[model samples]
Target: MTKIGKKATLLAASALCLTGTNAVAEDAQTQAELDALRARVEALETNRAGPANGDFRIGNTTLDVYGYVKADFFYDFEFDQGDTAFVNVIGEPSAATDGTFGATIRQSRIGLRTSTPSGIGEIGGQLELDLFASNGTAELRLRHANITIGDRWLIGQYWTNFQPLDTYPTSVEFNGPVGIAFARVPQVRYTANLGSNTVFSTSIEENVSGSNSDDPVLTAAAEYNNGTYIARASALYGNAQTIDGATEVDQWGVTLSGSIRPWAGGLFQVNYIHGQALGPYLIGLGDAIVGGEANDVDGYTVEFRQDLSDKWNVGIAYGREDYDLATSTGTLAFTELETIHVNAFYKATDNLTLSAEYIYGERNDVNSGQDFDGNRIQVAAQLNF
Candidate 1:
């Protein structure tokens, strides 16, 4: 062979070898990528079977569990009811007997919450239950079952929009005060933030006490908060029908509530509600609309709390509800309800608290010139989880 031919042949062989080596390396890289993908698929399948962390998950949804365990021990000096005082009943002659001692865990509760991502917003739901049930038995009862679509809307059972939650006073009793507006009902609510400090909310809630009228109760509220202070005004309107279906009464109420921090570790809260037929919303103290005529009612509550130290606090609260009866007979049936609470709380740990409270309640029947009074002392231990 000529010298030029020999050199060309040698270069051609080197090129072929290089091309073969490149092909082998490419094949090995492809196999490594396939192995990585397969391992990732297996890991995801394992995770789908159960949650690796504390929270449960399914697809894009995440579920969390939470609640508290509480035990309350109480002694009644002027009433016999073993549970929290129902002022309306405790004021009756039948309940005037004294010397009752009781203990219960009925307030302990468990709840489940879930959040899932969606196209419009995050969908969230909660299911909560406690041991308060029918016939004074220790059975699970639903407290809240509701769903929220982002921050704007909510559906199902939740705290009524007509009340200000921030103004609620701390107390050992399950039913804190007589004059506080409290109710949880099935409803559809819309909430909007007007600015950094103002919020407006409205809802249409199911009226369990409305007689013949099928229309739901309407509620609206506006709240303003500026670091140390919060103020709110809420209103409700509904129709109540008599059981006979012969009479329909107009029911409505307006509530103004606020909380202010006067100094470091000191706070004050006040609330006032006045309207016609506010029985169901005002701790069931009286009939909203009694007889054929609607009852006009007024309620007021005031509370002050002072933090003594990082682990100790003291509070005092007073509440009253008064009703106006058009007929003399109605006056005898329902008249006035009032309550006072003084409490001290100690934080045993970050998740544990111990508290003691003295509660005094009174009721009066104006027509009969009869007054019933009750007093109770309660101690409670609560552990949060």
Candidate 2:
């Protein structure tokens, strides 16, 4: 073996090593270029498919459409004015004594929601509609049209601030317990989150109908919610006006509502309201001011709901409204109204439900000293998407 032989062997080995390193670098560069090309193709495909899928994106905003289809069949043991009972108006002296059966899809609803990124925060808006029309025909009616700016301010028509939405019981009826504060009106609302479990909100809303006044209804509410227990308190102040613009009455109301989960899948809710001239704020049972005098009213609702299993649940509720018209010179159509509801719901699938309810109501006329009782059975099927 000679020095020249060793040197030649070392040079040949180094040349082979350099050639292998260059080949490896070339292969890595080729793979990087392929990945870049694949990503560009995917971007192009996504841009082309967005519009065809009905989910077109605008800037940084996304829009979604959602709703449910619901059908209700009902039978009444006593004749009422319509398919659904007018519990407050059932005890008139001219009431009929015939049973009725009917069906309605007025509770079916549709909605659109949008979210957009802004410099201040995320801006969100929702428009919702249902088939509950004003003229007894099933026409689309606006249920909610509102915009939420950032996380604190909301403007447009939404649930009234005095209403305790969390306290509402599950029911098969389109309208839940009658004594619960329920109303949707145009409002300017502000919400503040106090830590993780509490919230405070206030709003000014439209109060009376055709009242030629500048003052609006004022409301404030506070709520505390942990995973299992919830509590809420709200207050309302508004004005009542007459049709002829002849008289106006000042009205105020306070509501205390709460719900407790005693055990897994069991909930108990109670709502109590006492007010002068609360008729307009309630479920439109009567006028807040009759004959230029404000009516003092008290209403309460108690509901117990139990979930027997993942797919089955039952609820029982009782509600009452009492009017103090003993000293009023006006003719009172109803002085006391009571209602009971027992309902069960079964989830056929993740997006479909079947429910049945038995509803019984009694109304008393203070002026006529007459009482009328009505009973109804309702069955409903709903599909949500």
Provide the TM-score for each candidate, comma-separated: 0.83, 0.83
Q: Which sections of candidate 1 miss by over 4 Å?
A: 1-54, 210-213, 326-332
lDDT of 2: 0.78
**Candidate 1 positional error at 351, Å:** 1.4
lDDT of 1 by residue, 34-102 (tens): 556556444444443234232445677877767999999998888765677666665555665658789
The alpha-carbon RMSD values of the candidates against the true structure, listed in the order shown, are: 16.8, 16.4
Residue-pair clashes per prediction, in order, are 2, 0
lDDT of 2 at 356: 95
Candidate 1 lDDT for residue 55: 45
* Candidate 2: segments with Cα more than 4 A from true spot: 1-56, 93-95, 208-214, 326-332
- How far is 20's C-alpha from truth in model 1 (Å)? 63
Per-residue lDDT tens digits for candidate 2, residues 91-125, read: 54354557778898988999988888798788988
